[model samples]
Target: MKVLIIEDEKPAAKRLERLLLSYDDSIEVVAKLDSVKSVIDWFQTGKMLDLVFMDIQLADGLSFEVFDHVSITAPIIFTTAYDEYALKAFKVNSVAYLLKPVDDEDLSDAFAKLNTLKQAPETVNVTAVNSMDQIAAAMQMLTRQYKNRFVVKTGEHIRSIAVDEILFFFSREKATFCTLDQGKNYLLDYTLQQLIDMLDPTKFFQINRRFIISLRSVKDIISYSNSRLKIVLDHFSEQDVIVSRERVNEFKAWLDQ
Candidate 1:
């Protein structure tokens, strides 16, 4: 089987190559590409391949842009860091996706699905085979459908809080709440985990398991003992929000980005 890999991170690309070779000696990697422009150029060559493993977010832009510019017939298995809720839509709508830090069992299962597809009797719809459009649609849905407002009830009076007015989300006494700029906290129905998947990663970050903070909410950053970091938020008076030691690097990267 001839395979192509499109991933921006060199380490991830190399790791995937090693995993593929280890899984099946019959598989041959045709090429590895890093950006949307390079992929479009590769597809223009009209080189036929058995399969393609791609990352959803490339260095230049969304990998979906490749479909708009070039024609590709080979089936693709997307690799992403997105959560399960967003990924579940891909299987039902079109292509298969594996979560990042890809595992042996999942890679094996993805290969198995490719085999099943080859042996299936009927010809799969070109639109549905790759489901490129569906994948794009799902990606759009994830970014677009973020909770814009929340309704909170207080003594038979209900008020809606706009997402833009929120400062941050934190867990208190086993319930999740969003703090407003004015320092009011209202309980929310969703868990911090659910909100992490839904809220825009660029805007909100899960600095700790209990806290998902917005960029605008950060008042100051202080280096703490043992190499951890403390976060001060505007109008948040409960306690200091600490970024766990293990999460410090990723939290920094998110802030820098």
Candidate 2:
């Protein structure tokens, strides 16, 4: 059987390919395409495959954009970390959804279903577009929502702290942390990477390796070397907050906005 892996991360793509190869020597990995541009280029050359393992969000844009530009007849299996698009993904009867870090059991199950369907009569499911629209709507719902914040404990029970009472976020030793204006700290469950993705970028900016400062908490900006800027944050001081040289433009744009 032939398969194609469409993923952005080189390591992730290689990992998936390795897992699939371990499943069966017969499954050929036709290609590993990374960004939207590469995928478009592949299709432009009239490339086709029996099955495709696609990621939802590509580096350039969404994978759904592929259908917008190309006419593909083969089936698709979406491998995503996000669960918001399940409704739309099931529209095509031959379609499947596999979450990331796909295991052998799941890959085996999908392959079993595909083999079964291949032997049966050919059929087309027309509710695909409607389901796709539903999936899109679900994604919109997940874009942003703020819940009432409170203090969470790792070991000891403690009184709750309001979200507004927090001053700055920091990452230490690969784990993210939250600090209140009063100098108390909490180890957060979310990684700084995931937090950056979810945090309202308009209100929170990753000023440096260690901090994501709130716009409301920034007191003033001080000039620093190499066109970087140092920021003074209200109720938060210990480490001098400086914007890295790489992020100087983004910091300026965030301030201007």
Candidate 3:
């Protein structure tokens, strides 16, 4: 009943551990790992694991990388927030998959499958073609976070700025600008929406289509009808920032957090 959990998110990993411990004390959680690199190291070190609750995305790379160079003896249960994974291929190999915000029913079902796997006869290795496809697809989706500082070119000089220095990304006159809390503005050669996607969601909130406001930029909020809200930013803006009726609840939750 030994198990390993490979998840990047701290909160998610903790929650999963708590749930598993709550479910059965007999299930021994051998290790909680964050990246493919570490997992490879663990294999090289010859760790004994009976089962794996693996996440597709990791800090360094995807979990598929573990399968690429090494044969995993333990069966894996794929856990992900999104359902874009190659599930058909996993099903062919008799691997179980679970989508996140995992509930009690899903957990119970996954455990049933786990128990069934122990009783079933051994099968052939996962198909080579499907494995190759999964690895390639994983590589395409794996991207590094913006760490330390990023460079911005201005005429003849390149300016290095820290990620925290960026206060807000806004589109004005069909061009995008990066404004700092110090009131310094720099024009970046990227769309506001694109910038929004690049930055961490926890750090930046898209107040509207044209504005990707930072956490510090949120100065105040006013309630509106139909569960809508209006937010004011510390940075200058004549245009009123309104949180859509659909997004107001989420906005309020985020604001509280």
Candidate 4:
């Protein structure tokens, strides 16, 4: 099988290539690219590849840019350090992926699965426009106008809290408070729904109608009854933050990613 590796880090790219060779002596690595531009350039030359191992974040920007420039017939197994939401989201649109520091067993399993699917009568087809739209939607969902700071009024004084300092947001008796890492809460002018539209999806996940917890703030996640999940935050003390049953799978995928 001919494969291409697109990872920005030299060490990572080299290690992945070595692993690919180790997995199967007959497998050939066609190329190792570090940036979207280089990969796009390579694809434009009309060289064919059986599969591609791509990294989400590249040297220039998000690797999603490559889909905008090239039409790749080969299936891509994306690699990411974080951003599980995109992984799950893309999988629905026919993308395979592995997390960073690629594991030998996982890599082998991914190849095995691909090989198995290759034997099926039907083939997966992600045309240029389809791939572009899927990737664009995922990117748009994850990264759109996230607030870096919020202005809160305390008594007669007003202060700004950086989004990084926030642990979570909670609603109680018709009031919304922004809890910080230092265990302080400030009332905000917006609602949880509004916060959902404002915060970065990678940084904050809206567990339910009541709360949106930051990744840095999560202390633990416990499986609950009825296929639900209970989230514990570092300094959150307001209520039991639970992931609704309908959202359990997505919540787990986000947490694990």
TM-score (C-alpha, index-matched) for candidate 1: 0.58
For model 2, what is the error of residue 174's alpha carbon versus the real structure, in angstroms, after optimal superposition? 50
- Return the lDDT, model 4, position 192: 93
Sorted by TM-score (best first), the order is: 4, 1, 3, 2
lDDT tens digits, residue span 1-257, model 3: 89899899988988888888888878888889999998888878887877788887889866777877676767777788644323443444535677876666787898886676566546344223236565455444444354445578778999987878877777889988877778777888888767765776557777667777777887888887777788787766778878777777666656664
lDDT pick, better of 1 and 3: 1
Sequence-dependent TM-score of model 3: 0.54
Q: State the lDDT of candidate 2 residue by residue for 137-186, as single tens digits.
A: 54444444753465578676766766677777888888878888777789
Please report, as a residue range, the 10-residue window in candidate 4 with the lowest summed lDDT: 121-130
Q: Give candidate 3 regions above 4 Å deviation.
A: 1-22, 25-51, 54-64, 69-143, 147-159, 249-257
Select the stronger candidate by TM-score from 3 and 4: 4
Q: Show pairs that collide, candidate 4.
A: none
- Model 1 worst lDDT window (10 residues): 121-130
In the range 65-114, model 1's lDDT, one tens digit per residue, is: 78888877888888888765555556664446888999899899988876
**TM-score versus the correct structure, for each prediction:** 0.58, 0.49, 0.54, 0.78
Candidate 4 residue lDDT tens string, 1-257: 89999999999999898898899988899988999899999999999888888888899988788878878878778877855554555665554678788989979888876776677626644322137667888677545567999999889999989999998898888999988888999999998998887887777888888888878888888988998988888886557788899888877777675
- Between the candidate structures 1 and 3, which one is better when assessed by TM-score? 1
Better of 1 and 2 by TM-score: 1
